[model samples]
Target: MNWYVVYTKPKWEKKVAEKLSEIGIVCYCPLITQIKQWSDRKKKVEVPLFNSYVFVQLSETDRNLVFQVAGVIRYLFWLGKAAIVRNEEIITIKKCLSDKSVSDISIVSYKKGDKIKLESGIFSSQNAVIQEVTNTHYILVLESLGCILKMKYKKDV
Candidate 1:
């Protein structure tokens, strides 16, 4: 058996893992808990470490069985063969999941000249000139109109 990357349908990482597990295939969907605030309140939620992918351990002899799982896009591959992911990468991800210090990971201050992409919301598809970014918010000068707008984007943005 080897570790393989499974490309999942958009936002279907958990679902795919479930289906695979029910069929006795071992899978891993690493996640980190995040505290998010909406207009009215704050809540903690678990989110996938990788947005659209999950890892699985499967036998090279049973490669065809993997494709039968719902929501599995395909096994990540190169050069016309299944690609095996190194075990060390998975070990590191597992460490991060188990580490209490993960929540204490520092947020570096954003510099004026840094390039950024919008990760979500109305302007999710555009890039902006970052005027300033902080632990919880960012001030960007939207490129299209040259207007400055302040947004409270998630840390990963």
Candidate 2:
């Protein structure tokens, strides 16, 4: 079976993936661990790499089965066709996310107005645009949400 992309409710990728798996559907929900800091303490948490999206391997006949799962909204479509993700692409994503060198890969030089995929921290994997830079931090604008964030730069990233 080929892989197809599924859109899910907000913050439901993991739950949808688990439910699909329980019913014998093979699903992939890539997750990344990042540190979340609060006023009192800090902790590392696992979050979905692609928010609100999951990958499932199934044939056309199984589409309805997937739709039956809670939190699964619909298949991602392009030009009225369900989007098919190539196996190699999935493998590459898995490799990039699972590698021990992920931290090294996260470090990047960004410029003003450049769109960046947040690699770690509480906003891990969120897309934002650089608005300003300082010697010690970056000012990012979350364009979609109309919010601004200041992130401190760390050597290890």
- Report every candidate's CA lDDT: 0.80, 0.88
lDDT of 1: 0.80
Q: Supply candidate 2's per-residue lDDT for 105.
A: 29
- The C-alpha TM-scores of every prediction are 0.63, 0.67
Model 1 lDDT tens row, 25-94? 8899887777889999999977787777788998888766767888988888756877787788888779
Error of 2 at 114 (Å): 8.6
| lDDT tens digits by residue: candidate 2, 11-106 | 999999999999999999998888989999999888888878999999888788997898989899967999999999999989998789667323
Candidate with best TM-score: 2
Q: What is the lDDT of residue 151 in candidate 1?
A: 83
Residue 83's C-alpha lDDT in candidate 1? 75
Clashing pairs in 2: none
